[model samples]
Target: MATSRIRERSPKRDSLDDLELPEDYVPYVPLAKRRAQKYQKLIHKKAGLDFGSNYEDGSGSGYDSNDNYRRKNKDQNDSGRDADEDDDEDKQPLTGPQAGISLIEQSVELRKAQLSAEEQKTDVQKAMEEEAKILAAVAERKQLASAEEISKGIVYKDPIKTTWTPPRHIRAMSEEELAATRLKYHIDADGEDMPPVIKAFRDMKFPKPVLDYLKNKGIKMPTPIQMQGLPVALSGRDMIGIAFTGSGKTLSFTLPLVMRALEEETKMPLAKGEGPIGMIVCPSRELARQTYEGFVGIADMLHKGGFAQLKVLLCMGGINMQEQASVFHGGLHIVVATPGRLQDMLNKKKFNLDLCTYMCMDEADRMLDMGFEEEVRTILSYFKHQRQTILYSATMPKKIQDFARSALVKPVTVNVGRAGAANLDVIQEVEYVKQEAKIVYLLECLQKTPPPVLIFAENKNDVDDIQEYLLLKGVETVAIHGSKTQEEREYAINAFKSYQKDVLVATDVASKGLDFAEIHHVILFDMPKEIEDYVHRIGRTGRSGKTGIATTFINMNSSEQILLDLKHLLKEAKQKVPPVLEALEDPMEKYREMGAAGGCGYCGGLGHRVTECPKLEQQQKTKNSGMSRPSERAGNEM
Candidate 1:
């Protein structure tokens, strides 16, 4: 059997051929045995490495029994220890030479953060300032552009893309259509004497009530402004009427509003005592009152025609709220108020504007100029957004034009008069004088031809002082200012109207909505702050086809820029500059070169009494760069 000791191969021999079977194989090794095997392997492996037999130095067989264990422990300890040693070496104290670089790096990081923070703050502030200036300039350009458009008579087509040319056959229509057309066009005057716009209204054939109102007002003809405005306003469209003073702008909207009101009243009556169906906001108390009066006069004619009850209530400052509140309680069919008083009443819930269907802002340009824009917004917000809006102004500024654009939805703009339009009836004249000669010249003008003149002063104090001086000089004069009481202001207006006072000394308060029917002259005692204001001030006169005269005081000591502005305005109005003040552009500078003393001789160096140097007076150039210097004078004409 020993001679033939070769193992026999089984069918599965190939699969298990390389397997080694241990004589003491256990299903699972014991913990001690497993650990011993691991140590033995470590000893073998470490002994094979260059670290040498120190890893296996103990016990027998050139391999200490403890050698494998010691070797395994040494390897394990060395792995951990070596890693730790490398970290400690890295963490070892830095050399003195490397410290500066570390500190410098940290400082640079800190400075970067600080610089970033400063830059952020500066950027924010600069952005805010730039935004403000941009807004202001944008506003200016817009106003100038609108004025230019109106001046140039640039008309854009309607958004709805409908053709609006009047029918030629209508002119040859039968009696019924012709009558209807005439009514629509508002043929109030004689046929041959009618303006084309009036003829157009006559051809439209509006309702009877509208025609009746027009006829009653003796508006036998529509003005150019009215022709452009009425058609759109009557169509339930928002509108802006831009025309010079006395171009019948008031009638343009007034006739249309009255017609709409009459139509509504005749067609259907409002719920009893609900509220006003319409409202009109004016810039100043005087203007609001006058507008109310005008509304009342026209409304009276409508009432007699069997129309529904139409009433007007006035709300303004310088009056008792109790009286105003009483009016509100009675309920109004129409309201006219300054923004302040109107806003106050609105907040009290005295009357809800939800019922208001029509609104008009008369003198919208002047309202913004007087800084009533916020108040205007407050009032407009109270009305239903669906209501009709009509904005009327003598001249549209960018701020005003923008406001009108936003406030009015899809408005038809009506521009009246010629390009570079001024109240043609107003004869504008600029007077150049020594600062001292102003009062003397004013007094001379008063003595020669003062016919209920309105004198514009730059300040309220100047208004009062001028009034006093005029009175002391035996001239009948009155003043209106912020300080005046409601009664005093109204009384002053009455006095001016009654011809009791031949001259009125006023600041810009008198610039708007002041309708003194016979104002023959406007005297600019001081130049206005804005070029636009020059237009508003002069608009006070030459109203409704009446001729008027405007005189401005240009001093030698005043700014050349202001004088140039005045010159430009006058030139635009097609008026010639008087020769006396033309060459005195830099009066003060010229006088200074002439060795003038503490006071100017022309304007009294002050803007007052000639006893003082005219050139020494406070200059009236609100904006320093656009006007002439104060006049130099040696005597008081008064």
Candidate 2:
């Protein structure tokens, strides 16, 4: 294990001078020392190129081998030279060209390596971020899917059971629960035990003016609809009352409203031009005007001694705002306004509804159907939440039901007949014909009816054409549509109601509770697009349990869905469908076979001879899975 290594070689080394040490006695050294030794040896080996500055005495005399040898020995002894050190000296520095080449190559290579390393690091980070985002999105989607499933768990069942079942749970209950289940009989049928409220009304005799007005109208006793509705309304109860057109619902709510307004006027006598005492919002302009007339009749009686000049204003769209504002400015004790123009004027700082304690929505369901829901909500939100809200309509559908449920607080539901069903007094008849023959059939029906008739069309253009056709046939007729100005519409409505014109051709705008008392027939010139509308249209006739006729002009190739709806409605009304019309089967089948349902071939569904599709002819594509769609089913099973 003994070894000897020479430190520096001299020109003369005499004989062998061997040196040995034990392998176990070797000592460890730091890496710093080892690296420095390596660098020094590299520099020394090129000493000829490194040592150019240190010359003796500033003379350019290079040292000889002897002097160099002496200098090396002196430095080694002073520095305690180890045996492992190298012995080259006089190394030289690199030349300018070589140094530049080396620097450029080193810099370029270093930059390339650094950039590659940074790019790799960035890529790894981006991949991690993307993976995290994907996982988060997946988690969110799963949560939404689960929430949808949970929400769809709700089930619907009929509240009034058709089939009977016995109760299985007969166990005894706690006394508190048993007491809670007991029914309270607050309503008494005995007229002898009338409530103090009813007694007070009976005791308070009507003024001479009011009695005279009632006597003129020949209204001796209040109808049942009036009896039930008037008491509750006068008591300031929120009520939803439904009665036939002739059931005197107008008087039911109107009487109480007039009484409230009259009493308020007597007690407070609103400032010369202040807010209305009561606001009655009806669905249509004509209806609103009619309601105002009804209010005037009642107010004339109620306001005999106090506030004899009961100012009632009609605010509805189509009428000039300036005219309405003039009336509103003159001081309105009562207002009968359609929702739109009333809200419009109110928005423009026209009138204040804060003083309106009694609010009644006549034909409330129709108001909702005609897209007046948000407007109604906006109007109601302005009043105090505790205001007496009375909603009157001929029918209440699910939409109206939901709206009432939210808008009214613990409202009393009153229906004069069936829910969402029309009057039984109105006769319903359907005439099945080809689509092209519908116009001819309508003319024939008109010819058969000698009395004043109201024809209901589905669209504005149809109303115009029907009116023109009737006029050309020497029939006295007038048309009312939304396109007409308020003045023209008002004039037309007045003409129809006053019998200046025998027939009024109209759209659904005229359908909502416009009581043209003389209208003994309602001819459905075209089937309504929505089944719900049938109720409102037919309801225009058959006012106050009076017998009336409703004729539906159904084409052999009309919508089967509409026919089905008509059949169902007639069945509910307990009217028998004529066997002739009922034998047509699917209405759309004939139209489909003739390829007209696929469209006119030239005009598609536009029903025109032109080859181009008009701007309005483009209808939205519908999903094809239901019976409502006219297209064929995928499985032929339906």
Candidate 3:
């Protein structure tokens, strides 16, 4: 009974084998067995045998025993023959050493054949190698052509011949009259046989079209800078022009560069990829753009006067490099560029300075401040021949002086006023506004000034915040900073310049050589870290002999050293100094009292003496560390 109960088990439970399967179902096979069969088929195929037909029947379960045995025996016979051949090659004659040498030679030949087969390249690979060789040859040829062109010295014309002769009246002026003119304009010119100060643009012997253009712009008399700078620059001398911002410094170099470029073009026309007879290097794109426009305006006038049409190119960051490069194809007469972009173009071999005999570094001090000294030097090296170097800047510090000495050949130094001096036309007002209340106080400051106001902040984030705050308060404002795109910066600048916007919030990017006509007021949202920056920021207004107002906000957060410098600057300009700034103790006051010269002799910073200069220390440290120093304003652009 017990056996029957066990046998009856689970109502005849359905086993896996008893279940019906689909017609296409395949039985499971061990993974190892499947892989072995796969490898066997691959080996058979590689041995020039049909895998499926030689190993199994169509059903894949049966094999011909006789055929398999015959195939195996045939393979074994072939392998045996190869082994015998290898052994015979390795074998040495029992009685002679020559036999061993023959055996070694046979083995070496076998290896050589194997390596040749392994090293064979595909057709596509071979074609690529041939193309590379052709490209290298072409590059070498172009390099040699460039080298030959540079060696010819065709672009290096005589400076004296290229320079325009001054008018009879200017040349005839006596030393007494010239000294009187220099005294009247506060011009301190230092050089051998310095050119007399020009009272009018016509006195410099500029092309009639240039004179007409100046007249049309209502520029009746030359400004202080132009009076001396024009004559010096036109007299075929490398000149260092130190003048305040908006003091006609741009025209001082621009006009001369145009004249030189025009002379070169007229004498020998520029061929494709042949020019940039003149180059003006600026510190910022905005300044470069302004200079380019000024050059274009003069060039247009020249063209209208039946002169050869001058081609000018603006090279700077955030612009289409391809478009800038396109000008080289047609041969541009002049290039107005920032140091960064110009250096980039040179390094990439996009253009050469072979024909650039006229070079100007506008805002040279600012360029140095932005850590462009190396870039400027590298760019200078591209010029194969001597160039008439002109350095114009609002401030000329010792660093710039040293740079000028190395870059220029016996340069003339022309100063309209004290170097690093603030523009006297601006009425500077300083107020203590707490950081938290600056946004609230900014509105009051704007109401005090007219439209076309420029508001500057040291930090780009502060610029954006001020712009957003002004916009929310119903102020028509545009903002520019390093973070903005190039198009945005251009639009902002144009909008402010055209009076389309009542306010412009920006960083130090706009504080350099940008000329915004008729700006009524400039507001500093925060005190600049450097006193030089403060001067340039305020200089944005009070341009072209017009009086304007500058309001600066300071607080406890401001550096005492900068405050002392500001106090001194205000006093030097005869402006009313705030009690807070006047009360700030100069860190180097003791040194000054001990007969040390005021301010840093090296950098023109009033904060510390040359020995205590932080910038100089940093430079020394960087040099000692053998690391390249980064530009402080490298990323700050609009």
For TM-score, candidate 2 versus 3, the one ahead is: 3
What number of backbone clashes does candidate 1 have, counting pairs of residues 3 or more apart or in separate chains?
Answer: 67
Backbone collisions counted per model: 67, 18, 0
TM-score of 2: 0.59
Alpha carbon lDDT of each predicted model? 0.60, 0.59, 0.76
Q: Over the stretch 87-198, how does candidate 1's per-residue lDDT look in tens digits?
A: 4443544312342246678789889999887677644354444544644543442221123344555444332121233346643446565445445643322212121232
Model 1 scores a TM of: 0.60
Tell me the alpha-carbon RMSD of every candidate. Answer: 18.0, 21.6, 24.3
Best by TM-score: 3
Q: Residue 364's C-alpha lDDT in candidate 1? A: 74
**RMSD from true fold, candidate 2:** 21.6
| lDDT, candidate 2, at 637 | 6
Q: For candidate 2, what is the lDDT?
A: 0.59
Which residue segments of model 1 deviate by more than 4 Å? 1-220, 321-331, 417-421, 448-450, 579-638
* Regions more than 4 Å wrong, model 3: 1-161, 324-326, 586-596, 611-633, 636-638
Error of 1 at 573 (Å): 2.5
Give the deviation of candidate 3 from the true structure as CA RMSD: 24.3
lDDT of 2 by residue, 1-638 (tens): 12323433324446544434453333333546544544443444345443322122323333343557345434443454342342322122332223324667878988999988768764435444454454343223111111223345422211111111112231233434422322121111111111112212232234566656666776666555665566566656667887765667787677766767666766776775576778888876777778888877766665564545677887876555566455554557888887767777678766787677778888776565444555676676555324667888776643354456544545666555654566777898777667677666777787656668889987788889888888888888988776776677778888887888889888877877777776788998877755546777887777755788888877654555556556656766889876754664643344445444222221112122112223112211231231222211110001
Residue 107 miss distance in model 2 (angstroms): 64
